[model samples]
Target: KAAGSALMKNEKLVEDIIKSVVNAVNIPVTLKMRTGWNEENKNAPTIAKIAEDNGIKMLAIHGRTRAQKYNGDAEYDTVKKIKGIVSIPVVANGDITSAEKAKKVLDYTGADAVMLGRATQGNPWLVGQINNYITTGKTSKAPSLDKKISLILKHILQIHDFYGHKMGTQLSRKHIFWYSMHLDQEKGSDFWPNINRVSNHSEQYLKFHDFLYSI
Candidate 1:
């Protein structure tokens, strides 16, 4: 079973697994987990202590129960409670889409850091923006249309090289779809379907190049 299942609610099983993993690993071990199995069974604080006791060097908590999955707002109260009880570094995660939100979550939970997930899918520059805000108290400017197009092209070519033509061309479609959503909405909707149909890397590349430049 996944760790997010009943294992989260079973403190003994949680501790035993952590102990075994820590004892077996020569390198430092870190754990990433949701708050708990469900709202009523939230046992993250108990698990956090168990992790720290069993030699976990760091913990990253996504502030939602496994039942909640990707729905609803992430609550930081549980994360703050976990941080207070555990000496290990705690990373706050989930719903952290912007620099301001990252700062807010860190300040609220007193976590050592924040982790960004789905939000960075099409907007990788968000990492730099967040870093700039955290370090300099200034937000980085959004990338220009040309810059976005350049990155999309570069990213697509790299994907092609890494995965080879057949699989690379298949994998690149999702990225193209994501990048398109960040651009012209109407055009992107129209363009993605056609791009999705292209089977070859060269054709996919040319279509993306023409569509982006045309916009």
Candidate 2:
């Protein structure tokens, strides 16, 4: 988790892992890491150096210290410094929720690219949206109501396929909460208590559709 050390603390341990991965494969190697262990122990530059000293071709930096977690705005200044110190491509991550934010991050951090996390949870189309804007300088049309419903169904099916019925259904409930909140602004905290009472995936899906229909 974010509370733990960013990547593993032992430098040799990481080198060994990278060496093994490099030996096992014929292509480039990359690593993902947070700003550092905590506010005081922000060793991202050191870690980036260690990774570079090894064969890592790229490094992605999540711009929050372990102590910060997801509570505050990501610190792009640290990422900027990492880019200054490291020769490999540096990717920035954390709270990149929109194309505008993505562009700002790339410019601010001076990273080769930006990584999107929670922003893509229910909005995977964002990747294409960002690409369209970056390439064409225009945003795409919003998805139609019918497309939104279909995407909800598709997401449910994918979750069900990846995780079995019981677990998938359980996990889908949280996503359903997010969908409910986004699709129908009126359904606020009041809907969450009943979410646990929904019997199964079919019932939950039906409830969601009914809620959407009411909107």
Candidate 3:
């Protein structure tokens, strides 16, 4: 959602955010933003100072403008320049995947860190893998079948409990799709039948259990 023109144009929202959040908490303040609103209004540097001056401790910039949507290559040059202009730590985000890509982004953008988004879907251990490779030169072995099943079941239970049987069950379908899509050919097809039949929370759990027992 777009902010009102007055609020977006005032340019003091950054400082105000730092003031309010910094005053309200004892922890460090961090700001996340796009590459300004659009091309001609690339005011991240100006916003960065407002944050820094008002007590923000770190900044994260996604490498895209409002006009780009998710199209085209993410522009790291703006992120690189923001790192140069800001005194606080800067983190880069947008379409980052793999350890080598992470390394390349940090180097190219001169960011203090890289923020992983969609690439971490069903691959939560990615951060650990990249961190291990960067610090120890090795990625951990992939999770075994038993571990994968355990994680899927646990996640389903948590979602069901949090959102209740109805909404939680509805929410779990996508998660189930994500978890089961990587199974080997025979089991993959078997899993799809169970997933598609799910209509409610109890059915989802039952289907999941049935698929697991089949494995």
Candidate 1 global lDDT = 0.89
Q: Candidate 1, residues 16-46: lDDT per residue as tens digits?
A: 8889999998999998888998988988888
Q: Which scores greater on TM-score, model 1 or model 3?
A: 1
Clashing pairs in 2: none
Global lDDT of each candidate: 0.89, 0.79, 0.77
Candidate 3 or 1, higher lDDT: 1
Point out where model 2 deviates above 4 Å. 1-12, 24-29
Instruction: Write candidate 2's Cα lDDT for 167-210 as tens digits.
Output: 88888887877776666656735666766578687777677667
Stretches off by above 4 angstroms in model 1 are 3-6
User: What ordering of candidates by TM-score runs from best to worst?
Assistant: 1, 2, 3
Q: Which candidate has the highest lDDT of all? A: 1
Residue 91 of model 1, lDDT score:
96
**Worst ten-residue run, lDDT, model 1?**
1-10
RMSD of each: 1.7, 2.8, 3.4
Q: lDDT tens string, model 3, 51-100?
A: 78888889888887766767887788888988998889999998887887
